[model samples]
Target: MPGSPAQAPAEPSAAVRSAAAAAWWTRWWVRVLAIFVASRVVTTVILLIFAANQGQNPWTGPKPDYFSFATIWDGLWYNIIAVSGYPSTLPTDGGHVTENAWAFMPVYPGVVNAVMFVTRLSWAPASVLVSVACGAGAALVFHRLLRRVGLSESTALFAIVLFCVAPVSPLFQVSYAESLGILLLAVALLLLVERRYGWLFPVTLVMAFTRPSGLAFALALGLHVIYRWVRRGTDPFPVRERVLSVSLTVFSGLAGLAWPAIAGLVTGSWTAYTDTELAWRAAYIGYVHLVPFAPWFQGAQWWSTVMLGIPGWVGIVALVVIVALYAVLLFSPPVRRLGPDLLFWVIAYSVYLFAVFFPQSSTFRLLLPLFPLLGVLALPRSRVYRVLMVVLFLAMQVGWIAICWGVAGADWSPP
Candidate 1:
């Protein structure tokens, strides 16, 4: 062996080097970061195009800049909260409550305010900064969530790509609490999937205020408990874990109601929060008492009559079809592969929306929370399908921005 001529050190072949490069690029974190950045760039261009054509509107002057445009719609509400604290007395229209800062949670603005204080940035830039940062965090966590649920690295990364380019993904870079809420939700869900029950408490509390999904999450947790109990024969739901899950569910429920209770205590009106939320829908259906599972029907009827000049029953039927489609998707192979925890979340969140939401232009934005569904969209290995879906999603960003985000003369659409 020693007498053999010394062989030159073998170098990695071209294919091996190329593969190493590809592997480095495809590392989970690296891919997620790239996807997040690329998606934001695409969304930013779309937003800028819309912003360039934006006429003088309630929120901005004609041809507003990127920050100005990004901070429009609910961004304006968030800005208001960031600058001035919530009103001690709710603003009213005629004799009823109207849209006010109470509808916007404190966590997002609170974070933006902190960023502003530390960085000496204005509300628009600070809010955008917070949003973008949280968007990045959400993207990273979402990849983890997907991988935790059995997706391959490629599928998980592709799911993140889809999530970043989603029509509502503009919220990730804009001045909305959505990115923050999503970041927290991704973390909470990852924790949920990992069975890290103790960490979920604080995350859930903060996420509740970040957006109004705590009740939905509580419902999901309750259902998770039931499912675990039912499967105890195999899954082994120990007493200690059961106690934690149950207590967390109750805590989450309390957290869901905490904002309303705070608003009531501060304003001397128990209905303060609900009334404020109703005010937004009042534009469509006029003053109406809150009724569980009624808003969607009412909203369907209102949109059908107003937009299509069609009978409201037709809209109700359409709603039924939509719900059916969603149900079918839930049971489909791709979604079922996401595991019961994520499935539980999607179902619970959809039920929550059905019970409380008034579907409108903002419905797309509200659906952002169901981001786990992106895994289904990412499941197809077809190159053409994947590429086409990305293009379609990008196009949807343009349409979503034009119809929902851009204010074009007495616009009723609010993103």
Candidate 2:
């Protein structure tokens, strides 16, 4: 029998075949695409419903077309940059604030311009195309990151769904830098975690050009080096890896400043970028103050001077309480389940926002970069909990779109 041709392996059992099929369907990439598609479909449906309810046809309404809706606020500024270019001289009115194209980053507008050239479409349509495509890419990368951090396939998919339904997620479909910035950041982080040091440089560099959050990536890279060295002991990484890591940290930091440097060079003024930004801020605070928590103190003082003194003070207290609650959540059981790298980026980004950015109605949109951290919600397996979370996200998305983007216009907040 041994001398004879070995008999062919027996056919697998039906149960084994079924399990193999199931496993294939549950593969990480497969789940990621499925979740992304399903989420996008849901978002599209919600947008359509809202548009119809507003008596604005997606095709004919003057300001009701989806492209116009998506291309409002910052999108409009980006469009102007796409059609024209940055102004040679900053414009002002009555020695006060007016439009300054320099306040907007160039990546989104650049992409829109390229798209227009290729397709012969106008800026608005091109902007939507770039944003939606980048948004999809960001979702896929984010899902992959969740899995890399040890989530089960089901959990990772759920997290992607949550990200799509986030309150400010509409911004992802608009002509904004958030989608491209997040996609680049996710790529940089994934490369760093996988120890693909050579690839992190360009990815992080592009992220820097995409948004101010690029500086946060540099900080995250530095923190990553320290974390590895401390956790794994000295000389844990090979010499090449160590060199590449240090190079990326330094180069990405510089790249984050490249845009402002370019602006200054073009204008022949070192403070061109900051001056333009402060001009926009003048309407709110009238000046720039970098001291920590200055805004909170200023808000309290301003409230005291206003008619609703007690209520204003109470509002300031409420804001502090809310921030404290978020801090507590960062250390909660579910969030602790994330890997150290993920945790570090989330904390570093939040710190940057608090230290440098104003707290405004647009805060949620600004937080879109942190959406990946919401994957912690997937840690809980309770069906009721999952259902409740989805319901809450959907309700908040509807409310935000209705109040912030729908009725309020530019008077309330910049979408």
Candidate 3:
């Protein structure tokens, strides 16, 4: 009697069913979210401990309260833009540019304002909410991108941990545009990897308005298109598809220039954005020069004139070492391992940074966009190596937060 098809098995009881439902948390995204939350907790604790040790009461503030510490510096500017829209005319001091909202991009603040409108929350909380949510999305997209690029799941997840704990990662949690910019950049690149060029247009457009780093993405996509064209003898796409791809690439590159153009149009000056950026240079370095490596020469000359001692020589030597390290990294195996699109993007981005921007403590924050390159660390399969790197990353996070954000007064670093 029992041998007749075995009764096709009975349904599990309610307790067993509930247990199975709970087990659904074992999915990959669930794990990713868990790691993200845990990492944020660790970072927050570190920030709290350091702020306390520095005798700073994070709870009370004239500006950046405890809940709003992440919204300091440029983030404060974003808040202003969110609360009060950008002024039509730039503030100028005797024909020289002064601090203005034009320097900060709009997307981050726009989202914050929208959040405020919808939730009726204050600017600080709304800004932080936008950042945290975008940061979480970026983490998930980054993990997926790494896996899509052929890394094993373990390697991809490790890269995510490394990224979330990296020294500059606090920026991701802040009210700055880095979180939104990174999210857009990751999405654009992921779409490119999937060969969905048309979708890249809008994403890159939004990215352009988010950060100047959007130019890096546009260049990356353009280079990728050219790479494909060069290999056209074995080309996979038909003529129509190829034309569409090239059109998208060109459109994306143009979109990267749109924000600056808009700023120019708004201010009735072609050099509005550049002039505003140069104001900082004028204050710090006397005059702004358009020539490449001008900042390096100017920095060297200024250092030599000011220090006039072993400290001067040490500064020059340190500068040389940093430049040399960047050169080495340009061709390093680890950097090359970032694959063609990323390799080109990093190279173009680094060239732009070095050529146009002066090096400072905030340069580290600028390098946050290069988080994709951290995938190189995942190449090592050794447990000891991974453990050591994790330790180093966590330590650097503490150091960066303390030195750059805590100890250094405003204007020492842009953070």
Candidate 4:
């Protein structure tokens, strides 16, 4: 036996190699990156398919390329802002304020302009790149947020999967500010869950400017303060934290209103921003004053009467029932798993939307901010359920793009 040649080390079997690959795929960052890339590929294809069918519209000629197609809708407004800053003299039609760049925030286009300055990339590429990068960042931060909220790693990853394939996920790779806003929100919520109040100041400031979320966040902070105070016996809301939280809430509220104030100061018109916003809804309900918690009811009535040919009161009653159902959902066991911080944010944001937003096609896009609820959907560990939901979400992405992103004749749907 000693004289016999020693056998060389055996190679790993196919099964062993397969298992090793599986293990590598299970690593969190690897999985996240893989999912993000794959989702982008899928979304890109869907967008290309739709872009092929595109007709001559306000945004592009027939069958425009991907970048041209992507930069349509709100992207065109952002493009205008990036190139030419908002007009100091508000544009009016027939002595009534018209929809203009004031309705679009500055931070997103500003960032895109900066990117173009540094990288020498054109508007479409640079804007889409920023959005895609922010979206990827959002997905990573979202996983951590889910973990912080006490979900398991697998469940958290599943939530990311659902997020990447959601109906509005096309916003991630387009020229929309949603990706940046979502990235900020995921980080902000993670900070809130960690009780990092001081850091939230800067995050809240940027978030407020990036999108219309500051006031809602402030409302959430206020609610969070009250909740902690009520549960202080067990939660122990310290005086330092209490003072800081209170200050942050006030700051956020001011930040929320800061844009409108800036718009007014710049245009020499006190109602510049609100007027511009109201103009978009004018096509449906005509010019109206900004009334808190009244727009949704108005929207319901208008939509019911105009579209469905039904009584307006029926729409109002239906809205009430929907609100009631949502309130019930907030207390559901799955939503409660997200903890008080996220739950409060959801409630406050929903209220803010109800108060300000007119229920329309854009309603789904506005609901993108409530993405934390995806965690609830991800809670079920059944493999079949997760697969089916992912399939459904992908299908919805197709429908959403066709309806909202593609411009038909006199298209009313906006993503």
Compute each candidate's TM-score over C-alphas. 0.94, 0.86, 0.88, 0.94
Tens-digit lDDT track of model 2 for 156-218: 878887887788777667678888888888887777768898888777776777788667777
Candidate 2, pairs of clashing residues: none
The TM-score, computed over Cα atoms with residue i paired to residue i, of candidate 4 is 0.94
Among these predictions, the greatest lDDT belongs to 4
Kindly state the number of residue pairs that clash in model 4.
0
Ranking by lDDT: 4, 1, 3, 2
Model 2: per-residue Cα lDDT at residue 176: 83
* Model 1 C-alpha lDDT per residue in residues 214-250, reported as the tens digit of each score: 8999999999999999999999998999999999999
- The lDDT per prediction is 0.92, 0.75, 0.77, 0.94
lDDT string, candidate 3, 1-415, tens digits: 7677656688899999988888887666887888888989898888767655543333235333445576666777888887787767878887676778888888899988889899999877888788889989999999888888777788888898898889988776777898999899889778887888778778878888898865666567677878888887896766876887788767867876787788799888777787777776675576564577566656665556564544455666777798798888778977676667777777777766766776656778888888888788778889999999989999999888877776433435456
* Clashes found in each candidate (C-alpha, N, C closer than 3 A): 0, 0, 0, 0
Q: Which ten contiguous residues of candidate 1 have the minimum total lDDT?
A: 25-34
Scored by Cα lDDT, where does model 3 land?
0.77
Query: Which candidate model has the greater lDDT, 1 or 3?
Result: 1
